[model samples]
Target: MATPEKTGDVAVHDEIQPAPLTTTNTIPDEYRELDNGEITAEALGGMVDDLPKGYYRSMSFIGTMLALCLGQSSCYFGFVMPANVLTIINEDIGPNPNYVWIALIWNLTQAVAFVLVGRLSDLLGRRWFFVGGQSIGLLGSIIACTAHNVPVLIVGSAFIGIGAGVQLSFGMVVGELIPNKHRGFGISCIFVSALPLTVFGPVVIRSMILHMGAGWRWSYYFNVMLLTVVVALFYFCYHPPTYAMLHARRANHVSPWKMVDFVGVLLFTAGLLVLLLGISWGGSMYPWKSGMVIGFIVGGAAILILLVLWEIYGAGDYPLIPIHLFKNRQYMGTILTAAVGSMVYYSLLVLWPVQITMLYDTDSMAIGWKSCIVAGASLLGQGACGVLVRVLGKHKLQLMVSVSLLTAFTGAMAATTPETPGMAVAFIFLASTFLGYVENVALTIGPFCLDASDLGLALGLLGATRSTLATTAQAIFTTILSNKLVTNIPKYVVPAVLDAGLPQSSVTDLLTALAAGNMTGVPGITPGITAAATEGNKQAYSHSFQIVYLAAVAFGVCGVLAATNAPNSESKFTNVVQRKLHHTGFDNKTTKEAEA
Candidate 1:
């Protein structure tokens, strides 16, 4: 009654009238409906006030931001945890020649699963897949905690890898949902989470292994608890929009067959699997020149070629990666920067832990704490980069600077020797900070270069690139580390054993024993011989660090060059606008009219 009393001054005005005429030129019923479907002035005006503008207000906005943060942290944890536990596992299980396989399997499984599961997430609802992935990761930790042998541990690692692939899918989902203004900050948050986990994961695992009775198993169990808590939180709070819902609302169509790119998925999965298998077994399980290794490499190359062709030309309407995305120079440039950045970042991760343990002669716990410095610094660096992006309106320059810092850090680390002062640890920490800066910039810029419709597939390809680079880096760097160890250990340890007056048979056994880090075989040698061999082992490890550090510098230099070529801010903004217009079905005429 109160509202009815206020109904006044409401003018019902018909200012214009249209003359009615029947003609063949009249709009058809369907065309009239299509014209009506166009976004109206009222709709545009309404969105200006209601649409989310930044990270603080929207629930879905905040949920996605947190989801991406947690998701990235979980992925990095799985990737780096095994490397942290490598020495501890070797000590407990006795050094088997197959120890490298345990490390390789983690990277291999992630590379293989990323493409397959990412596409499935686009086909299914992202909310369930995201939650399910975390659940699967929890199961992996449970299996790892109960693993009794190397094979079981490898199986557990594969599950963790799959979970990582699923977690990565959230990058695409969140990128799709967040408003353009807040996206760079949200993506930077994800990378910020990664820096800590990368730097600290090893440190944490090492500390637990040294202190706890069953350190390695307990470390796995701890991850399970953490991931389980995150999963529960995600289930209760996160709600990603479904593909069906989005498509139905936006395109007014829902066809599963049209939505999926099944053949592309198969080819990509097969190609990645073959490539990873080749890298995993080429030198360790089978000779690099062996028929099995060569066959895998060749077959993987073939499938990759086929995949590119299908994505570019073979697929009529549905392609996993839209070929047109590559036409955008900014998009391709950002992706290139990301690929190189991932390679350097993960390679350093693979090498640094081994270097610390071998050089410092510390147990896992000490290494874990030492690693915290790098991870913590990286978080700070990422935060700084985000601030700079907002102030300067230039992200590519930050990427270039980060790459230069990483290169400098790597070169400084290469200069370290066994007799180097404790201050050298600062070099590693600084390198981690620069690496984090590079990561934040690349992650922020990559998705922004693409159209909204391409966000899911673009992120999937980004994950694929990161996984591929990580696997390649692990394979190449491990090969370098192993070769260096093999070459240096004999040169240093053998001469030291003979100089100490050990018998020929004893010297041979002692050298082999030292290479494996088992002092039991040195009992036959004199006490002088034992002391010499221990010093010799230290010298060999120092030499290996030099090799790893040099390789890191080279990788960093390449990353810098790639970053230098990255696209500028104006190009990225233009590309994003074009993509959004395309996805919203606003043709050039409509866009021009709206602006006018």
Candidate 2:
């Protein structure tokens, strides 16, 4: 149900046709029967109650969902393209230290925006927010495309991040639109559609960088055009149900500025961003004991503590996150499971591709294919997860088993020797597949347990956890690996270079390059020296990955233990049994009693 995006959440509802669907605007007489149970109280309750005219059921629904899917994919695609060409971008923009902020700004801004907008979106409908965000994102693309300096590009990325924050809202929209029976399938489609771009984004970017004859700026330009059409299509294709339109007009006397948990948003976002910055800068750009890093860590901790206290004690009539959501055993359990899964998988994402390039010496395309296998398999795993949950009748155990196996499997990969063939890559694929399952377990079970009113908060929290936790995990492990590489490379490298008859002066230069992670550069060295340098660098990096994978195994085991806390309140994992009603009689005693 979750896909990565930089935007806010989608609105409450969506539309769809029934089984044995038809494409024609005119429904056949037989096809009309398919509509019998198409609309349900659970599906339509928090969304629109009255259908709009010309809101034809079948293909129209698909078009709306498709547009959403494409919009999200573009954000991801745009994000990935820059990452692939960071080196070129760095070269083009000069060696300004601030250029790093191009990506960092997007990440922090998006994280902050998601937390703020999601809660406000519950009070305010998403139509205008959605359009405004797209407009802002387009502006970001235009800025980046036209940028002549690093600072300008950083500003552009920040705007893109704000716009992308709403991407998680698609889950809320999807859950409201599709029936419980079809929710999983619909959710899978949205996530799966991103795979094509995830798999091919590197290749496309590489082509644009290497052979397309266009500058790196064209990548942003291309995304801008693509998103433009998608925004237009979404504007035309999506028609909020009458209830959603009505909901927009009703004041409910709730001014967003008054109702929003601004203090909580400020504290939580500031705390998390500062903490991540401390983690990222600690051991690389600055020493852990540096005053700046220490200040960030200490201040972030204090702010986070205050955030929790405020959420519990001071939030009256408008909690940032409903207290009951945290108290709910299932919801908390899913959060734990997802956070651990994200940490492990993102760690793998950071370490494995490096492992491939060092251990196998593969090119960017080979890495792309291998990366695709991992991501493509993950997409397949997510789609099949809905079916697996359907058959298993309970997702907790299935997730536990998956995480347990992943623990053993991750450790198994750690045991690999440098000479191991595709064995490491194969295990990476398997590990990624299970990681997808762990995420889908939360996705599948979440909508089942929470009421429609809570869907946006639940989904926003889940998406935020996956992203921020993974980022934190990456910073931690990358620090570990980098520190280890700095210490270990001298031991394994200097002696090898001296043995290969390279002069000490030459060896000194070589070590400096390797220490900076530039194994491909020679700086006017002999072929034999180059070969020795490459082999020595590979040996050093391989050892670092061993530590990373072993740590991942430990997290994987913790994931298993966390899954045990999840509720088995229902035997069935599919949507069939959990029919949450958010209808008009919500306060009625009879309705409450029957639900209980």
Give the candidate number with the greatest lDDT: 2
Q: List the lowest-lDDT window of 10 residues for candidate 1.
A: 574-583
Off by over 4 Å in 1: 1-49, 52-67, 76-79, 87-102, 116-125, 191-199, 210-214, 249-254, 421-423, 503-505, 570-596
Prediction-by-prediction clash tally: 5, 10
Error of 1 at 580 (Å): 14
Score every model by TM-score: 0.80, 0.82
**Local lDDT at 110 for model 2:** 74
Cα lDDT tens digits for candidate 2, 341-406: 778776775566677767785677776555555566566667777566655656678878877876
Least accurate stretch of 10 residues (summed lDDT) in model 2? 15-24
- Give the CA lDDT, 0 to 100, for residue 154 in model 1: 75
- Per-residue lDDT of candidate 1, residues 428-465 (tens digit): 77876777677666666676665444455567777777
Q: Give me candidate 1's TM-score against the actual structure.
A: 0.80
Angstrom error of the Cα, residue 447, model 1: value is 1.5
Local distance difference test values of all predictions, in order: 0.64, 0.65
